[model samples]
Target chain A: MQKSTQAGFWKKNQRALAPWFFMAPGIIMFLVYVIYPIFQSIGISFYEWDGLGPKTYVGLQNYRDLLDDDSFYTSLKNNVIWLVLYLLAIPAGLAVALFLNQTVAGIRLYKSLFFFPFVISQVVVGLIFTWFYAPGFGILPHVINFFTGTPTAILADDKYATYGVIAAGLWPQTAYCMILYLTGLNNISPDQVEAARMDNAKGWSMLWHIIIPQLRPATFIALVVTVIGALRSFDLISVMTVGGPFGSTRVLSYFMYEQSLSEYGTAMGYGAAIAVVLFAIMLVFISLFIVRMLSQERNA
Target chain B: MFPKPIAQSGPWTQRAYKTLLPIALVLWLLPLIGIAITSIRPGSDLASGNYFGMPSGFAGWENYSSVFKNSNIGYYILNSFRVTIPTVIGAVGLSCLTGYALAVYKFKGNLAVFFMFVAGNFVPFQILAIPVRDLTLHMGLYNTMTGLVLFHIAFQTGFCTLFMRNFMKALPFALIESARVEGVSEFRIFWHIILPLVRPAMAALAVLIFTFIWNDYFWATVMAQSVDVRPVTAGMNELKGQYKVAWELISAAAIVAALPPVAMFFLMQKHFIAGLTLGATKG
Candidate 1:
């Protein structure tokens, strides 16, 4: 009788309850590690904690300090520079993808080889660029020598450090965008292309109107990942320069790491404040992304 | 079809395309190719300022052997596996459940929950760093492989869940509906019916996540401090500081550090691209 009662109960409520049951582990894990920490970090931003001992509420003092801090502005400006320059990968990738979108012999191997840099860790990429940019016996300096008759330590120069780092970052990011565009190109409806061609929509107009319109999904993802990549760029900077040569290379992310985690300081609250700013910048794009995904979900 | 295929163009255009193809690839991958060459160059060649010249001899074995012998990199690589394999299993396994729930069920707030995971996946890592570190410390798993594994599993679920839920949603709903008519329990339905179908996606997620976890550097530095637990990426940083100009050895180690992900990506090229480009073509 008890078993039948239980079965009956499940029959009536399983639809509603089973989802929660299934979601329990994933939801809990996400909450504990991801969602909850976002809020916790925001709350910490309003306090003055050094990652340990008692926390004292500071009521936006960290943000206030950030306003007066020149390094903070420098980092923020550098981040803007990164955001602007990093978008180059999209077009560069599309160009390459366009060039390579043919079935020549061994093209498959060529495609994978082109995407190779994205497969390696960023540390390796950073190291590679460091070697390339090294003043002595580096290929980059060798190339520059033809024009300037001298080798320049690009990473050591204040004017060039962030740009150099962005260049290193673009190596993988362009590969990433190329892969997306390659798949996007693959899925392009040949009928539409032929139709457009028949209508005399050739070359740039075809790409701008007919082709790019159909590639919207790939474009969206490329933009999203590229934006996030620009914001969270730490490994390359860390490996190449360590925000060095007068801290010209620090972005808000690296600045936060320096304030909170590095041996230089333990100002957890201050770090959280920096993170909150970065988070706020990300939230704008995140909401746009979420809204797009939601609309797609509804349509599905 | 899009670019007025070079084959349809004049023979000169086709000839030019073929000629330029390899030249473009060489220019694109120049940085990587440089490092690969550097990895094989002997220390004597580098010290003698033969950086870009043809190597006097291939010392790949010597450089790699020296890296292994003089460093804790072997232990670090082992630690990486200890953290990565479990993270792949834990994250992917948990996401299957979450994905099924979101995909198969009709529940209120499902969209909200699903979006939460998607948004959380893209959040800046710094926001989670302090709290996650503290949480691990509280659990007495700080600076241990288990702690890194646990955090990665949780963090990765965000992306994995997004991937998995979409994959599961694409599966035909009728399979589950028919099974439901026979009154098989929900768990049994998930296990016996849905699991088999999603195995391909699970494999894709497995390889992708393995590469992700293996190539992770930021979290490795944030979580593990000692060489006893440091993954190869973080350990490489220490070696970077110690051996300031052993470019050959450093390049060899970088290649070693990158080998797993590179090999995984090559072996599972199709699956890796599928996993990355799943939602890309639909729109």
Candidate 2:
């Protein structure tokens, strides 16, 4: 009698319970670790509290201070610069991928070598570029010296420090974009390409019309990743400049790190505010990604 | 196909393309090449202004030995493994279950749960920084390897679940339906029928997560305070502080820090690319 009861209950509730049983641990961990924290961080943005001290409510004061603070503006402007300039990686990556898409000998090894930068840790990439741009022993200085009369101190100069860091970042980002494009190129419909060729679509016309239109998926992914990479660019700035040279290289992410996490002092509220702004910026892209994913899911 | 294969071009054009390939690659990897060379160059070579020239002596052994001897890099590397291995297992293992649930079950709010993981996976880490740190501290896991590993596992599950669910969804649902009709238990259906089929997806996610957790720097610094718990990426910063002017030693250490992932990338090239290009082809 108990066996029949157990079987009946199992048959009735199995589907409902089974999914939760599988999803429970993952959802619970994600909620605790990722989702709840987003709201908590947003809530903390309104108050004035150091990491250690008593939490006092100071309603929008942190955001207010952010406007008057010069370093905050510097970080904001630099973030804007990062976002605008980092888009270059996509086209740069596409160009390289196109150049190497041929059936040349030893091309596989060449492709891997080009893609090596992305595989390594960013710390190593930052260190490599830092030495590459150093004034005395850095190799890029020689190129600058050849072009101009003197080899300028690139990282220490306010005019070019962010650009230098961006260049360092592009090294890996372009490689990533290249790999994506390579795979995309591999899967492009040969019939379409041949069809376009018959219509006299050669060179630029071919790529612009036939090739690029088909590469929309790769382009979208590349753009999304590049934007996120630009905004979340903490490691490179931390390693290369540490927001040095009169705080010229501080993006929103690094700026928040300096304010709250560094040895300088913890302005927990202010840091949270900065993080909220960064989160808000990322939300635009995140929503776009979700909409795309949702549509894809519906189609599936 | 768009560019028109070089073989179809004039012989002159094809020859030029061949010549330019090596030159372009060399120039592209110039900075890495410089460091790779410097990692082995004797200190005397740098002092004598042999930056670009050939090293006077191959001090590769000496520089690498001293990096291991004079620093806690070995410890940092061990810490990295501790964090990476567990995070991979946890994230991938949990993701398999979640992915299977989402893929197989015809339950309500299935898409909602799956989409939450997708959205959360892309969020900037700065937002999560304070609260996660606080939670870790509250749970008495702060500044410990377990703290970093647990957070990595949790956070990585967001992405891994998305990947795994999509992978599982591609499998033929007919198999699951047949098994259900045969009166096999749901758990056994998952274990015997589905688990073996998702092995490729599991391997791909494992290698991808390994590289990610291993290469992580932001969380390492935020969560780990001391060298004992610090991963190599963050510890290399401290090594930079210690080896202020020792470029060769620093370069060697940097190379050492980069090896495992580079080696992994080469060894698991197929799975790594499959994992990374997960959503690039479709939506």
Instruction: State in Å the error of residue A49, model 1.
Output: 1.8
Candidate 2 docking category?
high
- TM-score, each model? 0.98, 0.98
Quickly count the clashes in candidate 2.
0
lDDT of 2 by residue, B1-283 (tens): 7578999999999999999999999999999999999999999988888888889889999999999999999999999999999999999999999999998898889999999998898888989999999999999999998999889999999989988888998999999999989988889999999999999999999999999998999999999988789999999988998998789999999999999999999998889888888777766
lDDT of 2 by residue, A204-261 (tens): 8888878998899999999988998999999999999999888999999999998888
Please identify model 1 stretches exceeding 4 Å from their true place.
none
Cα misplacement distance, residue B241 of candidate 2 (Å): 1.1
What are the per-model DockQ values?
0.83, 0.80
Compute the lDDT of residue B26 as modeled in candidate 2: 93
